[model samples]
Target chain A: MSATIHFTIDGVEVTGKAGQTILQAASEAGIYIPRLCAHKDLTPHGSCRVCTVMVNGRPQAACTQPVSDGAIVENETAEIKELRRNLVEMLFVEGNHYCMFCEKSGNCELQALAYRLGIQAPRYPYFFPQRALDATHPDIFIDHNRCILCGRCVRASKELDGKNVFQFIGRGAHKRVGFNAPDGLGHTDAAVSDRFVSICPVGAILKKRVGYAIPVGQRLFDKRPIGSEIEARRAKGK
Target chain B: MSTKPKVATTSLAGCFGCHMSLLDIDDRILKLIELVDFNKSPINDIKKFTDRCLVGIIEGGCSNEENVHVLQDFRKHCDVIIALGDCATMGGLPAMRNHVPLKECLEEAYLKGPTVYNPGGKVPGDAELPLILDKVYPCQEVVKVDLFLPGCPPPADTIWQALVALLNNKPLELPYELIKYD
Candidate 1:
């Protein structure tokens, strides 16, 4: 039998099975910790730092850090929120995220998080960096303009689809996602049905010829906040 | 001799679509008119500032000398400046050229584009034209922006709520539906 761990997040008691990370525990307990790179199924990459939470008075990546019995977790404090906001803002300026015309505007997790965080505009200057677009694939395309380097595609392609189709190249501001081929994504064994194709949190990876099929008002995250679903879990638990 | 607070507005590298959305407040404009007076706006065709404005509504980023001059002028004359729409907040569609060299852009537009048929095969460099900047800059980057309302045009309701809150001296906490980036 798996042991259950008990922890308090923001003074609310929560329980989780042993070997679960703080994020997984908090999520099951209906506590929403803002995150960008940590998907439910994929292993935590901890690149975005949007899910940084205070564990026993020290900061740690909740998605990567394991939960401990009687551990004190602080997720929604003012200091942590401000830090998360800065991280999100930097992500905005680092890339040329033209959200206004983007196909993933309403449904994008990054864009929705910005709204949830009350980011009317980024505090930093827009970098307006020059990025590339790879459209060699017949069914899929990669627009580097909107990528946040969350590493979702890299992890999903490797772990879920069991394919080495996506990988990261470069360093620092020059870093970008690269496909597994000398020529392009088309040359790689990447298929439209691959998990990597639909796992991107932004418009970085998208299927061709299916843009803007959903209208603005009817789209996901249009009327509600991004973590509303997770937060909704609170009511169900009670 | 108007007693209401005066407001001014302009579009730099923008389409004036934000201004149209402002008017999309529909009949709430009657409420707006009762609260504030138009000082210098394309709406009233008041070409130049006649009074010190309580608020300056600026749309679009600074893409050229004229845009910079107008924005600096606004900073000097207005008490509060609101950067409205994606262009003013974060260099919208016009900023797509930020990555490309200016020479290439001019060449493509005037000399080498598919639709271009320049008889002289020359880029226009008239002295009357406003000098283009190296890159587009958001309104806040150039000057102090008191507030930012983002979106393609910020939806008329969002603009109305923001303006109303500002005029009434209330804290502007936008609702979920009113604060979309697109």
Candidate 2:
């Protein structure tokens, strides 16, 4: 039998199984390492480095880094906070993320993270690259302008739904999420019941006819900050 | 004569929703007047800054030459600058046009739009009109902002708290509910 691995995240002692990553350990200990691509239901991609934490004086993506016994992990620090702010800012400018008009205004993970990181405005120049929107699908739509390419939807479509319907197309700056169907989302076998509909962390992929169903001040992260649920669960551990 | 703090406010490239939200302070507006005096603001409809103000609140992003000019004037005349809304803090709804080419945006609005009154294909290129910028820029990009309060139109309570903190010479601490992007 494998022994439990113990680690300290920001000086908080945490324990996890031998195979669990540092993020998983710290998360069980009630410390929320900010991440975009590391979802509970899917395998860690480590594509977004928002969850980078200092381990043994070196920076490492917590989602992918396995927890070792007595590992000293510094997840919250002034330096890390500043780094996250810049990353979030870059994400904001790299796309046409006009949160004021987006249906996912309050519910978006990116937007919530921006608020969490205290990013009033992006310091970088707005790229404003022209993108497209695909509303061909009758039930769902994809607005490419809002896509951050975290690969959550792509991973969910393939690993969970067992239908490799989505894949990343192109390379470098032109790279974007594309479906397997030659005709677009409309022709794809993706259904509303698939995990593909709920895996998107932004307004990029959305279910049609359900925008603003919850209304402002009633949505997730409206009053309660993101990760509060995890933090609450952590408190209950005490 | 009262020794209340003097304040100025302006809106550029933004809907007056922020200004409306400011008035949304409701009955507290009377309390606000008792706390601070308005100088150059749409609320008072003051065309010019009567004198140098202590705090200047900008409620929109810079989308044209005129916006830059006004922002610069505020920077020169005001002691502290506060970006007051999502538009001012980060180019809000107007920044959506940033993706489209400026020429195309103009053409869509003027020459080849769904609703255009002109019989002849003509665009508004009057020399007197303020020249539009290629993309909308948040107030911080154009000016040194001392503070930022972000929201589509920050809740009236948030604005009031910020103003009170500024007047009282204390650090502005906002509650979670007061902080929202929409």
Candidate 3:
């Protein structure tokens, strides 16, 4: 009942489950792949493009690519690092992100990934997309500008709460999250107890009243990069 | 009154946070009051008049019959209507119940096994309770909205800048920091 697939990653031969993705296999084998939108509980949304790896001489998102027998995978190529850097730069310009003021500063996955890739400054012109704030609920907030369109909040709303409250509207740069109804937070029946706010990997959706309460030194994942943090958590069996 | 456009604000089904955000402008509300004629608001006297108003701001979603009627009335009276909160823009939090069937929601909230006075009584079929829309809709679905100022209620500075843009007839632009989700 066991099926295995062999592939070469960074010139090293590795074996994984037949249905495993390259990223999944790489992670199990202690290979670091930079990603923002990929989470353990949620489905993969390849919006960030930071996990792209060269497969048989072509670059593709490692999170979506399945590991095949005898396939050649390169995770540490200069071209891939450059591509990841460019992807991170695009993400920075597509939204408004002031890391100094952000509550997620030290613990942010995007910020950690950027530091890992050594992005000094974004080359693209900032789009400064017009986004709305939804502080209607007393506990949480939805800031459209910090959103990278990763659909984590949307998925959280649907999967955890059983409510498809948030959805993407429009196309391209005009794309933004919308409610299932026009009613404000007080009027709609959304429960305040849902964990969607905590699950959001980025600052797009946030806990309203809890910001700055933990101070700078004590926040979780504050002292290390996300990759290392993941490694640490794994070591602890978390 | 001055020749400037008269603006009215009201809340329907939402928490009054959006209105609070408008007032949170600190002393800036004084400046805004000087620019536009404040006709009706939660902080001011509630009066009904036939005078044509230039802008009407409604914060909240239409969850019941009265909420719908109020939105329609605002549409009839004002030249522009702005949905100012997440509930107004995209059913913010309340629309989360759209996933459940209306009957199931009623059972969970009222009926179930609870021994309330109406435990044995049939659910009221009266027309007074507003018919719940099958799906939560943004303000644009119920009526034409001139502009959308999305945010939990948006920051006070963003609101001030938007008002200034409206007064000067300039395109409203939000800074990247202001629009970000965090």
Per-model TM-score on C-alpha atoms: 0.99, 0.96, 0.54
Estimate, for each residue in B1-182, the C-alpha lDDT of model 1 and write its tens digit. Answer: 88888899999999999999999999999989999999888899998888899899999999999999999999998999999999999999999999999999999999989999889988989999999999999999999999999989899999888888888899998888998778
Cα error, residue A142 of model 1, in Å, equals: 0.3
What are the runs in model 3 whose C-alpha is more than 4 Å off?
A184-188, A230-238, B1-182
- DockQ each candidate and list the results: 0.94, 0.70, 0.01
Per-residue CA lDDT of model 2 for B34-59, tens digit only, reads: 98889899889998988888899999
Model 2, span A1-238: residue lDDT tens: 7689887888887888898988887777788899988898899999889999999889999999998998889988999988888888999889888777788888999988887876767778778788999888999999999999999999999899998878999988899999888788999888878897888999999999988888888889887877787788788988
State the lDDT of candidate 3 residue by residue for A1-238, as single tens digits.
5499988988977788987888888888767788877766767777777888999998888888889999999888898888889988788767766564577765677766765665534556445444577778676777776788778777877877787777888998688877776854544556667766777767777777777777754555444555774455446643
Clashing pairs in 1: none
Model 2 earns a TM-score of 0.96
Summing lDDT over every window of 10 consecutive residues in candidate 2 chain A, give the lowest-scoring window.
A117-126
Of candidate 1 chain B, the 10-residue stretch with the lowest lDDT total is B173-182
Q: Model 3 misses residue A118 by how many Å? A: 1.4
How high is the TM-score of chain B in model 1? Answer: 0.98
lDDT at position B44, candidate 1: 93
RMSD of each: 0.8, 1.5, 15.0
- Candidate 2 has a DockQ of 0.70
- lDDT against the true structure, per candidate, is 0.92, 0.88, 0.72
